[model samples]
Target: MDKRNQSTVTEFLLLGFGDLHNFKILVFTLFMTVHIMALTSNVLVIVLVGVTQSLHSPMYFFLSQLSLCEIVFTSNIVPTMLWLILVGHGKVSVAQCLYQFYFLGAPVIAQCLLLAAMSFDRHVAICRPLHYVTIMTFTNQLQMVTSCWFVGFTLTFFIYIFLRKLRFCDLNTINHFFCDVAPLLRLSCSSTTSVELTTAMVSFLVILSPFIFIVATYISIIHTILKIPSTSGRHKAFSTCSSHLIIVCTYYGTLSSIYIVPPRDNSINMNKGLSVLYTLVTPLFNPLIYCLRNQDIRNAVYKYIQSFRRRKVVL
Candidate 1:
């Protein structure tokens, strides 16, 4: 089949985390637990936020969207991984591989914009309290979310389209656990100029743009936090933002290290290991960070669990 006209790739073989002498099964079980915990925790946060009227604020709204993205992100990668690990088969067609790439990457890019937007929301809420409602209005927030989705999927779709034009006659075996750009590019037989350039452009725009904005917002936030007169007041405000900051830093730092930094070639396993943190670990933490650190969510979860037990006892 001609490269430009090619529509099918017979099959793809994913070389997962790596060959463990006898520990691959353990790794599989570990990820299975993560999937369950991630799903349950994020769902609970969504439930708590949706049902509780008090939780209907810009911060929580951003959290809600973050939870949604984390859920979609985890769902995209984990089920396929589980199927592969359990069945000892990670074979995928070109279509399936591309689909997985789109589904996974779009949310990830969207999430970057979403987090930057959330930082802005926090900045306004904390630093410009009087105008918070006016600045972060329902319409404005919706527009932001929509913009994130647009930017995210647009990059993902373009990358896929560009890659589709190239021929992969050299190597068919994927080195990483997931369909990452660099690893996949290693397999191409045609000129990688377009793919590499496009990927670099997209990555620079997506990662760097949001990162700069987020850092600016946080700098302003810290300045404002320092200006507070009362220690208690500062503590309370910092407490609210601290968990979000932790989650944000963990996500972005590891992701930047993985994609932006040049792969050492020898430490490809380190790259895959870091990928697991973003893909598997973040989903598990998103809900816990929001709920455990948030009183409204904690209260709602407590009530929901109690009510369920009561109903069960009555039955």
Candidate 2:
């Protein structure tokens, strides 16, 4: 790895998805729609959780936090992507690129923590109904949320510093949409030893570790669900776990494909598709997953709508 050519390389060319003029507007519209839908749904979740006091329990408290993270996550990437597509500046400053990578990476890693904690919260609620209140106290819940942020942001920020030192000598085009760690690292002309190592460390700690925990916890949950003598009780337990399971599968599955595997020439399309899964699709699904089977959320949504209607009529 020679620093001569790399150090001279300043900005990155984000070769965005493809070089096709035909579907440009349609593709932009679709991505924008996802961004808007995600924001709208996540915002609705926040408001619903706030206004519906019954949802103020530890589970929904964590949910509210998840929604907040989602907002931060999508805003980091989608707006920039929209701007680039609209204004035609595909190359971003190195500093700006690193910063975007940090923010984007932080939320994704943080989501794993939040998701795992939520699973634990659910486990306690279902398995240990009697001691759930004492164990998952407000303080404990707060601690969990704090831990999620601390680990997420700290891991990504440190990694960002290593990534910033790399000199991009190759094609500056950042393949895919937002600045991802893999594609960015591939362009580095300098030794990527530290950058790659730090990335792997964060991936293991933030992504893989929590994914395993969530899976194990869900296994226990499934056993419990199966043990219920009454079919209705079993069904109810499965119902509660359904949304979380789907989200876990979607978020972790796509994310793991990107970070866990080495970059392959054949898998570029797969990476692009998976990036869309976690970035655009997951956020949109979280709100719906939360309220879909939840009677309380559904009721609150209706109540909120009805109140809005009454206010409009009065106005």
Candidate 3:
């Protein structure tokens, strides 16, 4: 790979499930259905939170932000993958690839922070019920959500800045579904030691730290719940935080598997499968898990439906 040959590279091929080309139609249909379901469910949560005044608490506020992040996060990558599947063309320009990875990484980090925010809200509510309102005021919630978005963008910007300087040379084919940092780094002909180290530290800050905080919060929550004298009281306490726990576990479980575990030669397919689970399947199920488990959300949805029905009858 000489300098002359390296200078000609301007595009990269995304080898998205190339082995599954025989099942392209099936894969396209499956991903399309998942994308629609994810969008509808997340948007429904947002709309419900906005209209249902009773649901306007610090927890629901963070939940709505999480939904918004999921919508943007999935939108950044899924559509392009679906289109490429349909067209059988995986070519993406250097600029397009970089932007895609940048946007996707931002939302991914935002979601991690949003989840941490949600856990902190739960901790305040469960551990310090008397001061929960004072601690988690509307202004504080707004600032926390805004900070998450800001940090998300800032961290990813540095990542993309380093990535942009890497020389791709002639090895421009990305062996994954999207322009993820790992795949892109793999394709870079230049040394990625600094970029890799930076990414690792960012991952710890964005993903690992939040995850640890959430765990600590839940541990305190559990300790608090155990002190309650009555069985029904403990049940009631657990019920409220259960949905958040489910979502947190589902998200971090798959995500940790990807980042924590070392990649290997034989596990590329396995890694892609895990990516699909986290990126595609997790977002689709998040709203459903929350809505189904939450009685308040269910009641709000029911009331909304009844109001719509009454209007239809009047018209």
Candidate 4:
């Protein structure tokens, strides 16, 4: 409103799980364990894909990129969350909060596009098997990954610009773990209608569009699998993309719950819980899912372990 009445808020107090008054230490321990596990698992995937010769296909290349995104996405929020859980609250300057938001959004948005690209890779491999090699060349794969990161960061940068324009007066407390767009918009004194509109457009572009593409891609894949007369043929075809399908379901399901579904009476708590699914649980489970389900990844891990053991014995 009036300039004289407004007090600039240089920082925000993140009230993360503050209600766990008697269980702060327990919660902190749990969060710390998950954070460490998630980082380790994702890093392992990246390393395996890079060093293993058999794992250098387009599929594994995309999986490595996905792991990289998970590493960035989880690391951006979980450390702050652990600190907040330990201390009951934490202060983040305005610039720092915006930076946090940017890092958070960029990886997620990039991952969304990457997932879609992965699905397309699967579709080509199964539905158009003859053309798979020529279509999914190293150059094409690099271009796809580059575009995902570029578009993801560029779109989020615009949202950050809009967020910076809003004035925060007096109110400096965030209910959620990190600086999410919803809580920040609520605390802004300036009109957020335009910002919300811009966010909506970007969400559609980055989230909804990619999800739809993945869905359509899977439909074709299923159709192709069904046309195969032999049962083993169908199974083989299905197995190729099943890991990606599971991840797509988990990722989009949690996202839809948090953002697309209508909020209920306990929406704030519900949102927080669902946020944990995508932000923490999904990343932690991703590499696990791929490792358990994909035979190549399993073999790679086994070979790497064997090699390490042999080297140790020699030394």
Count of backbone clashes, every candidate in sequence? 0, 4, 0, 0
Model 2 segments more than 4 A misplaced: 1-7, 87-89
Off by over 4 Å in 1: 1-9, 87-89
Q: Comparing candidate 2 with candidate 4, which one achieves the higher TM-score?
A: 4
What's the lDDT for all of these models? 0.82, 0.83, 0.89, 0.91
Clash-forming residue pairs, model 1: none
RMSD of 1: 2.7
Cα displacement (Å) at residue 203, model 4: 0.7
Instruction: Write the residue-wise lDDT of candidate 2 on 200-292 in tens digits.
Output: 787888888888898888888888878899999888888877877888888777777788877788888788778777778889988888888
> Could you tell me every candidate's TM-score relative to the true structure?
0.93, 0.93, 0.96, 0.97
Expressed as tens digits, the lDDT of each residue in 75-189 for candidate 3 is 8888887877777658999899999988998988999999999989988888899999799999999999999999999999999999998878767877778888888888788
Clashing residue pairs in candidate 4 are none
* lDDT by residue (tens digit), candidate 1, 103-158: 88899899888888888888888999999879999899889988988988999999
- Given candidate 3, what's the lDDT at residue 299? 98
Model 4: residue 314 alpha-carbon error in angstroms:
2.4
Task: Between candidates 2 and 3, name the one with more favorable lDDT.
Answer: 3
Q: Considering every candidate listed, which one attains the maximal lDDT?
A: 4
Report the C-alpha lDDT of model 4 over 263-294, residue by residue, as the tens digit.
Answer: 67668877888887777788999999999999
Output the better candidate (3/4) by lDDT.
Answer: 4
